[model samples]
Target chain A: MRSTLLIAWTVLIEAIRRREVYAIVVISTLLIGAVATTRFFELQGLGKFYREIALQIMTIATNLTVIIIASRQLPREFESRTIYPLLAKPVSRLSFMLGKLIGVMAAGTFCFLLFMLVFLAGCQYLKIFVSPPLFAQFLFLQILGLLVVATLSFMLSLMTNLDAAITLGSLFYLLSSIFLSALSYLYQFSDTAVKFILRVMVFSVPQMSLFDLSEKVVHQEVWPPVPAFVIGQLTAYSLAFSSLFFLVAFLLFRRRPL
Target chain B: MNNSSAPLIEVRNLVVEYASRGGAMRAVNDVSFTVLPGECIGFIGPNGAGKSTTMKVLLGFMFPKSGSVKLFNREPGATEARRRLGYLPEVTLYYPFMKAKELLFLYGGLQGMTRTQLKVRIPKLLEEVGLAGRGDTLLKNFSKGMQQRVGIAQAIIADPELLILDELSSGLDPVGRHDLRDVMLELKKAGRTIFFSSHELSEVETLCDRVIMINKGRVVLESPVAELMKPLNLFEIDFEQDGQPQTRSVSGAEKFNATLAEIISSGGRVIGTRTATRSLEDYFIEIIRGHEGSGR
Candidate 1:
């Protein structure tokens, strides 16, 4: 575990220095900045518009960057053969994969935090009324979603090359985000076999949309009657799936030809 | 602390295979060898000779299809074993966006070397590798030789007991190759066990005490370099004349007699007819040619 932490810390720091984190920051800033600057005339409340745009930007930035960054993370190492030196050390395959997951997640969290700050500053300058805790929950969800995405990306990288991993990871990300929604609709039908298959698929995917309470907050709906339970579910979901993915990734990497 | 100091690495019939489009292709076939501490062993082979595959399996990057590999008598993949092992892959691929310091720090941290240790050791290593002032430069901007130096530094950062270096001089110029050779000699003198893999026979010839030559996934020969280089049965008769020494085709024992008769006839004397002593390059070529006909 000490070794794992050390490895994770190294990976995290390198991720920062490698400008992968900065790339996320610059792109997120641009996204939020553009959205915040957009003029919405009929919406009456300027603060509301800024807050809404900020939330949207934060969500999109975290989701897209996490997928793009994390998907290429391990595949790049494998392709470049940099993983050889690290794996040649006294690190377990599990530790290596987990370190990468943590590193990518840390990058996501840092990027989202930066996005959140920019949004807050924009809101303050615009005198917009924004829900800090609600926004915090949204950021938390984005982090969880990113963690799930990172795990899936790690798995895909182990199974395929960079381009194929990216394509498959993006598909998985899209599916997980809307998986439950698709299942909810499928559940509406009375057909048993179709509903069963949809349920199985939902359970198999990361159930990413479960963390999405931002839409509720945006629509002025009752902001999640069960915040703690939802957080717990997302936490357990991320940990379990991430562990499973790491196991699969490790097996794949162990068997892979160097 | 001689031969009885315990083997740094041990392998018993190790096998490694890959899942190919057609079927499972065995990359390393029932190969086995051992390296004792302080022994500088050369892993020489032709291309696709399973040298890298064996190294990868020993490093736990790839598991064997069969047989057991042990590092310091522990399971090869065990963390304890890994902690003591150092590896420089044939490809000196670093995170291109990372500065030399960041890359070394990452590698040091992975090896569980503390920050304090890194502070003291990194500069020393950089200086040793002659990259003292370039720590701030990103690896991507560095030349291939520079990257190779950093790669060497990364391998030795942890002060591992077992060093596994693959093609350490593959891309280096002659001077760079000499520099790498000097580093390997220094490591060996410091009581570290080193397993170096390369197709360049000269590099291995100068550095290794024992050479294990592999061709096409199997060990073609394994012996002390001195013993392997001992005079072979085939003789090279310089003939005291040039112009492609005349040859007559004959079979088996007749070939030897014909050569001796030619030498005796052409010789105002036998004029130093001696058994062949091949250079490392000649031996390498012979092994490669042997590969063309034999699957192994």
Candidate 2:
């Protein structure tokens, strides 16, 4: 595990050295600064307007980072055939894929933290006493969301070209998390067979809504510890998604002509 | 276990196919060959004649549709098999963003080498491939020939027992080709088996001990350079006969002199007499054309 993390770190350093990660960092920083300057406003009883904006911005940034970075890993390898030399070594395909996943996740996580820091600093500059716990929950949700996006993108990259993979992966993430949230209401009123199918679909796509503590964070409400059920489900979903992606990558890459 | 005489690389009835847009195309068909230690065998063929396909199968880039390839007694994709073999593809594509030194280090590290090991070996390889002073340059900026040299360096970095090079001389000028030929010879002298494919028949004729010619996914000929180029005894006699000037062929021991005399005796006056001269290149072309014309 330690060695895998070290390889991840090596990948990160290489990414940063090439200015790819650095470019995203710069862009995320600019977005944070831009969002923090929006005029003061209010949104119903749900949350403070600025805090809501902050959460949304961080989520979008996390999504962009994953889409942009993870999608590039395998496609670039395919184009350059660099994977040949790498695979020719003692490393397994799983290790290479996992290393790529880690590299992308680390980059996303780093950007998430940076955006949070900038957002909080902006709040402080405006004399808004943003509680530490509020920021913490926002970051937790952002990281989890980014994890899903990274895993999905990594998987899609194995089967499709870079741009299409990113687009389809981002769509899958958005639809699975947001659009699929409506299935519960349908299950509550639908016929027995339809309800069972809806339930299965809900269970299959990640219940990202459960992990989104952003609403609670923005409201400055007392935050509950992430439920073990939700955490377990998310973990399983992430693994299943990543495994599916890797399996496809393995099947496709094994037969790749190079 | 002292089977020192066993072939360094053994392939039996290897078959490889690819699903093309038109349909499934057989790239290699019942192709079987072996490389003895210290032998530099050249695989020569026209474009798309299964040269690269066979090499890819040997390197584990593509799995064979049928048959078996055993390198060092291990399957092609097995880690143990790869560790003992080196490969250079026709196109040497590297991570454009990485400098030469970093690229080498990353690949070496992937092979489970320590930093110290890479540091010790990279410089010598760099110098050998004429990239000694340009280690810090991004691979993207290097010219095609320079990149090919670096590609060769990486393949031989581990001093592999078997080196599979696909079109090694591509993009190299005559001088560069000569220099690389010398390097290959040096490696062969060190007891390494160099299995390379090339369309340049002359280079194959000059460097290879035995040459395998493939046409349309089939091996047409596999013979030693000396034997492939052995002079054919058929004589061509041109003379002006009763009708119009015609050519006649003679057989047996008298074929040569009889043809010569026939031309002179017919008052045709042996205008010209030529014996079949077969070079390796001509033989390669002839066989390829022969097979291709037969619609094989």
Candidate 3:
């Protein structure tokens, strides 16, 4: 476990030190800064409008960062031949995978925290009345959502190349709401075989929308903070999907020749 | 339990293959050898001759198509086995974002060294590998030779019992190689096992206890360094006899001594005596040439 953390620390340090990650932070700050100062069409101060756009940007940017970071972990290791020296230590393949996943998650969380700060400053400028409990729940669900993305990216990275993994992972995260809706819409007109395939897709592909609390937070007048039972259900649901993806990734990686 | 008498690394009739476009390419074929504790063995071969392939199998980076490999009586790549070993890869590009000190700590920490231990040892290791006072520098700014030095620092950080170095002096300049040789000599004095492959045959001649020469995925010669050097030396007798300069070449020690005595008795003064020894590179090429088309 110590070895695992040590590996994760290296990844985290890289994520923190690499100039590109800071590029994301700078771009995100500018985007949020623009949104905060935007005139609300003809009106003066529409806090919800600014907050909604700000939150969406954070979600999209953070999720994309997570996918990009997670997907490249294995490919970069193999490409640079860095895996030889790393695995040369007492670390196991399983630990290596876990470390990468944890590191991606930690880096993603770091990215999100920076986004959150930017977002809060934007909210302060717009005088947006943020609900403490709803915001906390939103943060919790977003992290769980990020974990699912990280693990899925890990599995995809092993199954394909870096570009394809990032492309697929980002597409899945970006289009998840449409995907869930499309499945239900397609289920009506499909033949038996197509319906069977759709059913398999439903069972296999995680509903990224289920983890999204953005709508609830964006339209705060409609919903309050979620109950504990639902939060528990979301936690279990996310873990089940993450474990399935992680297990598939581990099966593929354990005996692989480095 | 690891028995002290057992071979540190053992391989039997090992074969390894890689998937090429046409089919499986056999990279190592029916190779077998053992490395005992406290021995510095040099694995020398040409490009594409399966030296790296065999090392990969021994390190558990790849699975062999057939036969067996064991390190410390445990299966290859066993975590327990790896903990007792250190490895320097053929291409040594480490985490470039990390400072040299942090990278050493990372490798050492993974192998179960405490931070206190690393903090104390990393400075000394950097100095030993000729990187003193450069511990805080990030690896990206380091030259290829400097990165190779960092690779060496990481490999020996935890001070494992066995060290496996591939292309030991790959990017080192003369001074860097000289420093590395000194460090390796010190390790040898401390009695650590080293198994390495190098295109640099002179390094092998200077450091190896035994040399294993391979060609076309097979080992052609494996012998103790002392015995191999015995027949390779050419003794020369230089003398002035009867107001004439003369030079005589002899093969065996007895003939050389006899020639020397005969020259001395014939009213002669010996000018100088020299022994021209055959280099390992010459011997390697000859053996490799002989082994061509000998593979079954």
Identify the candidate with maximal DockQ: 3
What lDDT score goes with residue B136 in model 1? 93
The lDDT per prediction is: 0.76, 0.74, 0.88
* Tens-place lDDT digits, model 2, residues B136-176: 99888998888888788888888888888888888887877
Candidate 3 lDDT, A17-82, residue by residue in tens: 988878988897898788777775532336677767778888888999999999999999999888
Worst 10 residues of 2 chain B by lDDT: B1-10
> How well is each residue in B1-296 modelled by candidate 1, as lDDT tens digits?
26887788898898888899999998899888888888888998867889998988887777798999988898767888888888899876687777899788888887888999999999889888778989999888988888889999999999988898998787777887877788888888898888998867887888888888887788878888877677666655444444444433333455766876866776434445455667777877876786787664
Candidate 3 per-residue lDDT over residues B40-127, each given as its tens digit = 9999988889988888888889999999999999999998999999999987677889998998988899889999998899999999
Sort by lDDT, best first: 3, 1, 2
Q: What level of docking quality does candidate 1 show?
A: medium
Better of 1 and 3 by TM-score: 3
For each candidate, what TM-score against the reference? 0.84, 0.84, 0.93
**Residue pairs clashing, model 2:** none
Candidate that beats the other on DockQ, 2 or 3, i.e. the better one: 3
Q: Which candidate order results from sorting by TM-score in descending order? A: 3, 1, 2
Better candidate number, 1 or 3, judged by DockQ: 3
Give lDDT tens digits, candidate 1, residues A140-182: 7767677777777777876777788778877776665566676
Query: Where is model 1 more than 4 Å wrong at Cα?
Result: A14-31, A34-44, A172-182, A192-206, A216-230, A237-257, B229-277
